[model samples]
Target: MSRLYSDIFTNRASTGQASADLSEAHPKFAVNKVDFWYPGKQALYNISLTIPERSVVAFIGPSGCGKSTLLRVLNRMNDLIDGTRHTGDVNLDGKNIFAPEVNLVDLRRRVGMVFQKSNPFPKSIYENVVFGPRVAGQRDRARLDYLVERCLKQSALWNEVKDRLHTSALALSGGQQQRLCIARALATDPEVLLMDEPASALDPKSTNAIEDLIFELKKDYTIVIVTHNMQQAARVSDVTAFFFEGKLVESGLTEKIFTRPTQRQTEDYITGRFG
Candidate 1:
């Protein structure tokens, strides 16, 4: 049976245990001893990592190394896949996300995501930015108008498209559309953003724009990005995690991971000796 999104629109307070757990102090996200499977195959094996709040963490590895899979695990996006399962805990702000009480809708609202390809809704730019807030029952026209401008400015696309807010989002260039998507994610006021190779499909200039946005967004939102681009990872991430064959080979400061990785596999992958 599928798991139902708990509590719908109800705003349940954090449990006493959840409140007390906060006293112990932990990172924004704590994935401990996690093992994940997709039907017949295992995708991740006993992975553990901590992501500090208001920082960018990059997962870099060859394709199929489980970087994207782990990215989806953050907000339980994998739950949409049939027969997928995982063991262990993924905690956000000291609360286990897999706990029965976690409201899926709220969890997703708090942890917004962007994909490798820019996927703007076929609607107007204004509509795209206000989508999330509207779905959550926000009806104040003034507030929504404010969100559109604020989020677009935060995404660095306000000046470029401010005059065309009513234009279809698809009318924008690739980079602009991507920024619009970023603005949409920000509209929900998410605390965390999960980006799966967010710029891999864009041109160099567009890629740079996305990278700059990531740098700016990290000041307010914790970000986890999966990228095959080693240079991009090195440039944008505060911390880097290297994975190989579903196992976390090494993870640490980006400088250390790139210049002084302890694991031979990590060194080999980063040095272009092997993927």
Candidate 2:
């Protein structure tokens, strides 16, 4: 294994051992020495962080700082982009996700993602929610219906759209569309959910709704979100990591990172001193 991957694997093992000891008290996800590149450009540095299971971990930074890139790496979304390259390791539950034997499709199913923009399909609300399970080979009407209802409820959109399951997804408001996208993500029953500025384009009301939904979802799924909004990070995340120039500058409890960041760069960015 490369040095980066070796370090990552070792760290994941250590974090897993520690997490096992405190399993009843804390939730965690292990990310160790991860790096990524797009064609000729490197987007992430030697990044290592642990996000507790069932907890919210937020990445906050200015544009081009690799926040979104790191988020994509979590669920292997970067693989969809041609010319992309990666090094190091990203592991969940102590399993190295980049290993050759690991199935990318199954990994993605286990680790779902919500994009910056809400991209709902042209299909009906019900169809959107059932897309994942359907692709996974679930053809039973009853199972699809149950999955749709369950995920929609989990995303806090069932009550609003329950009466109109057959309605076109585009007919919904922007806020509703974003929620619908979230519900679609939940349909897969993923263990980890990655969000990249999921509420950035929504109105304040919608943003608040998304935030509330994130807080609620953490009770079941480990969430890793990348956002440029500092207050949003502080509001929703249990732990916050600050990135600058592709490097992870600092990471700690959200309260501390916002209020008492250890690194000067983190303080500068959070305090609006620099991007």
Candidate 3:
């Protein structure tokens, strides 16, 4: 009874197409008329969206507007909640991830995630970075060493922590720990990275580092982030999706979404009239 994501696809049966940015290039992930319910309350309603490959997309809205809920849906994290029910399709590379045949472990490995606060394992820094590969049966120490270095470098944390690889991960600052988490996610060579407020708990300097890392990571991994910082979304994401009351009010290029949203609801929220 593993969890599932978008695993089925059908145009007529689909109910959550929010906007028309579906170009010829198949989206890395597609949310088609997705509706979610938790017990008696509906957290999301008819939400349709698409994520392209090798790009950074941001989900922004007031708290409880389903920004993070939808983010969780990407990796099937929501499935862990009791009495939660979902409909519609969430397609990754045109395959509905919810299909029974889909391997949740493999899906999680390919679609890695970072959370709002750093949650490094209580282990050595080197161990933290190599844990994923090591668990999958990687025992060659030289190969493990190379993987750790490469992943940490990709996450921009190799330089600062190289001298302390054997130190407890909990000893690092909040930013370094978060980057270590990112490095750990990268160790598996995931094609997509999901970040749920990856910088909200850090200082300004740490936030900037995470933002910079996002910029660099976009070249190799398709990224989606849920953020409360509008400015941070603008700075780090190429596309933005604005959610209101669990519905996708508007989505488009970051510039257009910020500067010229066609929907009045989007304008009101973005302009500070209301959230």
- Against the true structure, candidate 3 has what lDDT? 0.86
TM-scores for the candidates: 0.90, 0.89, 0.90
| lDDT scores in order | 0.87, 0.83, 0.86
**Residue range 135-186, candidate 3, lDDT tens digits:** 8899999999999999999999999999989999999999999999999999
How does candidate 2 fare on TM-score?
Answer: 0.89
Q: Write the per-residue lDDT of candidate 2 for residues 26-110, one digit (tens) a residue.
A: 4345778888899899999999988787878899988999998988888788889999988787777888888889999989888
Better of 1 and 3 by lDDT: 1
If both were scored by lDDT, which would come out higher, candidate 2 or candidate 3? Answer: 3
Rank order (by TM-score, best first): 1, 3, 2
Residue 39, candidate 2: C-alpha displacement in angstroms: 1.2
| lDDT: worst 10-residue window of model 3 | 1-10
| Model 2 misplacement above 4 A | 1-28
Clashing pairs in 2: 27-52, 27-53, 28-52, 28-53, 29-51
TM-score head-to-head 1 vs 2, winner: 1
lDDT score at residue 137, model 2, on the 0-100 scale: 92
